[model samples]
Target: MEQHNRFWRIALLSLPLGVFGLFVIWPLFSSFYYSFTDWNGFDANYSYVGFDNFAKIATDRLFLQAAVNTTIWMIAAIVLPTALGLMLALLLDSRVAGARVFKSIFYLPICLSAVIVGQIWTWIYQPDWGLLNTVITQVTGEKFKYAWLAKPDTALWSVIVAWSWQQTGLSMVIYLAGLTAIPGDLLEVCEIEGASPWQRFRRVVLPLLAPSTVVVVALSVINSLKGFDILYIMTGGGPFNSSDTLAMHMYNESFKKYLMGYGSAISVVLFLIALAIIGLYFRQLRKVDRIYG
Candidate 1:
């Protein structure tokens, strides 16, 4: 029996381990190697240029713009979704009527596809005949048309808002779970002490939700870095690439412009950033674990 059990254990572990190595590990190393080359993706013949791709990225104007936009996205994803989700969680956690219905309504966006959300928002932001313009005109009794997606200034933010709306539901669900985990006795103690609502929340609640906050922040950062599908479907990184993220820049470079090596370098940089964030997440988790213990 022991021998049979050992065989099965090794077989189960080995299968997954082999698959992970073949798929995940192989692609990562291959991409890293390609980042140092001048391969046009299809060409069998290419030069091994040491850090030339990386060097070019430093002075690339399009890349700089994408970087800035991605940074903005990261900040907005962390701040907006977290704040809004927490507030919704708090509201729903209270003794309110139709809480389940309200939760479902807020979480509905998360179930929709990014492509669908992008397409819907695109129509909503249309200048002349869109919903937003129609409402504005109705309110002010003047036909005020604004080209939201077409403009360089407002394009990135418009997409960010759409993305945030989708993400808010996920954040709210996570926060609700965190809130549910809090002990009733702990809350009762605060009430018994005659602690003000704000004081109790500041002193007791926020500290307890630190783990959930870490998870939400990490997820937001990763999602922001990987933002592509919605932006691609909506803008194609157009309007002079104002709303282009690093992922979109990589796609445009590799597929559109046939600059595979340069795109690979960008991917490598993005991968490094994600890896750093994950490392920080683990470090934070360890600290939180220690504190809770």
Candidate 2:
């Protein structure tokens, strides 16, 4: 009976495992292999020009810029939404009036696809008559037609803002859950001990919210790493590559420019970066679990 059970379990798992290997594992290995070659997508013939593609990275000005932009994006992506979400969670958790309605409004964007959010923000940032500019124009009694997504100076930051808006709701929700899990009795004891609101929040609340913060940060890191879609839809790494992240550069090289080998090299670099970040995160997570346990 045990043998039969084990056989069935393997049979049930085999299909999904097979699919995962075929689609995900295969592509990943292919990327690594092609990174060593000079494989233009259309050509059946390619040369194993090893390390040449990787060497280009040292002198590639655009790649360096993209790397810098990606660094900025990751930092902003982690900080902005996390800070905003925590603030919102604290506000709503205080039994604010119409909290449910506000929560719904804030969370609505996260439910939408990145493509949809990009389009919505695209309209909002329209230079002439978009929502943001119109509001600014009305408030200042002057024409405010600055193109948010069209100019190199502001394009990346603008996309970052839009990305933050979409991500904040998820963080807020996670924080809210954490807030609810805290014992009201514990907070009452702090109040009885004459702890001021600031002291209580700082001393008692923040420490208790560490677990939630970890989860929020982890998701932020992962999302920020993969956050290419919204950027693509909104900017396409345009305005002279001002908003190009590593992923965008990879896509442009592979698909648009047909430099598949070079693109794969970029992908390998990105994957290693992501792997390092995630590995460090997991190490910290283990420590947290041990402490919190």
Top-lDDT structure, candidate number: 2
Q: What is the lDDT of residue 1 in candidate 1?
A: 100
The digit string of per-residue lDDT tens for model 1 on 92-115 reads 999699999999999999999999
Q: Which stretches in model 1 have alpha-carbon errors above 4 Å?
A: 1-6
Model 1: weakest 10-residue lDDT segment is: 231-240
Q: Which clashing pairs does model 1 show?
A: none
Cα lDDT, all candidates:
0.93, 0.94
Give the runs in model 2 whose Cα sits over 4 Å from its true position.
none
